[model samples]
Target: MNTFPIIETERLILREATCKDADDMYSYLSDKEVVKHMGLEPYQTSTDVLEEINWYQSIRKEGTGIRWGITLKGKDVVIGSCGFLNMQPRHYRTEIGFELSKLYWGKGIAKEALNAVMSYGYKHFELERIEALIEPLNSASQRLVEKQGFTKEGILRHYEYTCGKFDDLYMYSMLKAEFELG
Candidate 1:
């Protein structure tokens, strides 16, 4: 099993998601406003959040991906989740993704958590490229990645099926060299 290390920021902690975090995760995951642009529909119950949490744990154990629960430094509640997805060790690349509660939206919490995770990806995984796929309508997410120095590559038509339809997405990427330069 791979170890998931605790990552700390000035105001946040990125750590493993646990079953105990179900309620917190559900608070956001079940909110229509929060999951509007997400690939999955809003969860209907805390059990759904628990199942999602289990899935997150499974991927980490399988070494396929890593998801961290994002919490305020002094709080025990998780406000969001962020981490690498679809990690390809052979290609030295991975995709980054994050979702935060609407309550925390605009507070710079997501950026802080993602910065810590991205730094880990670059340093530990030695990733050549870190990519993000954002639904075209998710302006907040677009701005977040742009602020992190990810360059917009282009549109991927009908990129994913979600919420009963295919969604187009904008691809953003930051190469290892660019990350180092920035």
Candidate 2:
């Protein structure tokens, strides 16, 4: 959309990431454990985080995708991010992705925010499909998408070239007929 969407869930706020979120975003994103499966290197500086946030905004402006800064309902600090990228609206599809702070690990926050965003994307775009390409080693993400009604299509062996190496990714997808808010 021309304007960023702010989605609210039971205990979270999925809003636009601003320069204000640079520190909070940098904190979690810079953690090696957090970015391990994210296909991105651990950010080395706040400038890097801001540039990432800039990419988020640019994608939205270009009508290619959207990303949201994740925070607790009563808090202002960004603890994570989730969004659609590589959007192919004409094809009725988009890629989904998410990452959370190590400090918030094991909380159901990611799942909650994810469901809300999925619901929005389904209706907002009249989407026919939503795709998630996850690193084969990211078991948590595998479980999350499966629980949310996605079906694993297959492994795209060495499908993506990033971080100086080719990586196999598990392709999981939820068709429009299969989408149901959890």
Q: RMSDs, each prediction?
A: 1.0, 1.3
* Residue 168 displacement (Å), model 2: 0.7
Candidate 1, residues 1-182: lDDT per residue as tens digits? 64679999999988899988999899999998888887888999998898889878877877778999999988989999999889899999999999999999899999898889989999988889999999999999999999999999999999898878999999999998888887
TM-score of 2: 0.96
Q: Using Cα atoms with residue i matched to residue i, what is each candidate's TM-score against the true structure?
A: 0.97, 0.96
Quote the lDDT for 60 in model 1: 84
Once fitted onto the true fold, the runs of candidate 1 whose alpha carbons sit more than 4 angstroms away are none
State the displacement of the C-alpha of residue 25, model 2, in Å, after optimal TM-score superposition: 0.3
Q: Please report, as a residue range, the 10-residue window in candidate 1 with the lowest summed lDDT.
A: 55-64
Q: Which residue window of length 10 is worst by lDDT in model 2? A: 1-10
* Regions of model 2 farther than 4 Å from truth: none
Candidate 2, after superposition: displacement of residue 160 in Å?
1.3
lDDT of 2 by residue, 57-130 (tens): 89899888899999998899999999999999999999999999989878988888888888899999888899
